[model samples]
Target: MLIANYLLTCGILQANAASGMAVHDDCKLKFLELKAKRTYRYIIYKIEEKQKQVVVEKLGEPANGYEDFTASLPADECRYAVYDFDFVTEENCQKSRIFFIAWSPDTSRVRSKMIYASSKDRFKRELDGIQVELQATDPTEMGLDVFKSRVN
Candidate 1:
């Protein structure tokens, strides 16, 4: 009788485990669907704003056809590509500029370039340093000029 009871308990545990795995798979599928839907909506909005043209001009054009632009976008650690350009200012301050190309996964071939600027601080935290000088200078035209140069 004890052996029969043990076998029954083992079967019940296996069944429960299988059900739990099924539930986990279903939840994962739902999450991916929701995420894809959200990304699609965002792409549509960006297209309406003419952001696609801006991205294309910055990146020089996508290697793949425009129809596959969305599929070319990076996911997680798989970014499309990155380009970095560093320059020295008149005040002897060093700054790094980065451009990240993000593509869509749909038929629109929509793309965008995310730009970033950072001052290189070599001496940690010093008051009279290059980083401080860069912060004090106006950065209005720096980004625009850099972006325009990329298109050419």
Candidate 2:
């Protein structure tokens, strides 16, 4: 468990270079730890409007699984998450991939969607090791079937 005091200033999160939202350095640090060290199941992130920057919202325990990861995304908001995905390939070999998910539920506000959409690439670029990118606007869009399909 890390004692996080992360908050980004006006840096990343600008798709068109007209906005001020940014990603915290801790976000990239945590991602590196997850990518290189396998330290977390997933990391949830959100933009703190008051601060106008992206910040870490939650960290899944090392023992947590995919169900825990899917459940952690809110029903009516936008979020960014990184998940360590492990699977068995057709050749009976074990493999893992780092997935970056943009969870923007349909029920979320229009403004929220806009902000998340605009900032996604910048934030994604900050985390350099993500292997797969998934954008989910509904539950069915990101189900196990979808995950499996995208893995290959």
Candidate 3:
């Protein structure tokens, strides 16, 4: 009961107040372009552990693809990302979906993973209009097939 009460599930993430991290104001402003203005294809975020804040790591241009989004994440670290994926339905129509991804690669340190996992919910709630939420711990988990499967 104590563990359940401590880790509250918020939307697609678990909220752990232990970290007490704050979401930087700029994080939302940047997401607006991707969510409303369609100016960005993706946005990557990293936690400034020392500062106890989440900050934007990178913003993908409208011309960027899913591949670019995946490549932006470091091989041995954990990060958060948002991607504006444009897909065509069987009806030959164009549609787009915004995805919120929590990238916690297995190679990352235990402490680092714990921090990211704990802070994820606080950071994710700052952005609006995320249609899909994905938690990936390996490169294979972030592949296009996995994305396609989840997109539906």
List TM-scores for all candidates, in order: 0.19, 0.86, 0.86
Rate residue 43 of model 1 by lDDT.
16
In order, how many clashes per candidate? Answer: 3, 0, 0
User: Clash pairs of candidate 2?
Assistant: none
lDDT of each: 0.26, 0.83, 0.82
| Residue 122 lDDT (model 2) | 82
Ranking by lDDT: 2, 3, 1
Q: Candidate 3 at residue 77, lDDT?
A: 93
lDDT tens digits, residue span 42-94, model 3: 99999887677889999999998877888899999999999888888778889
lDDT of 1 by residue, 29-112 (tens): 322332333211111111112221111111213233223433333332112223233456667777543333332222322111
lDDT score of residue 105 within candidate 3: 86
Candidate 1 clash pair list: 70-104, 70-105, 71-105
Q: What value does the lDDT take at residue 30 in candidate 1?
A: 28
Give the alpha carbon lDDT tens digit for every residue of 67-141 in model 2.
Answer: 999899999999999999888999999989888999999999866777787678888889998899999998798
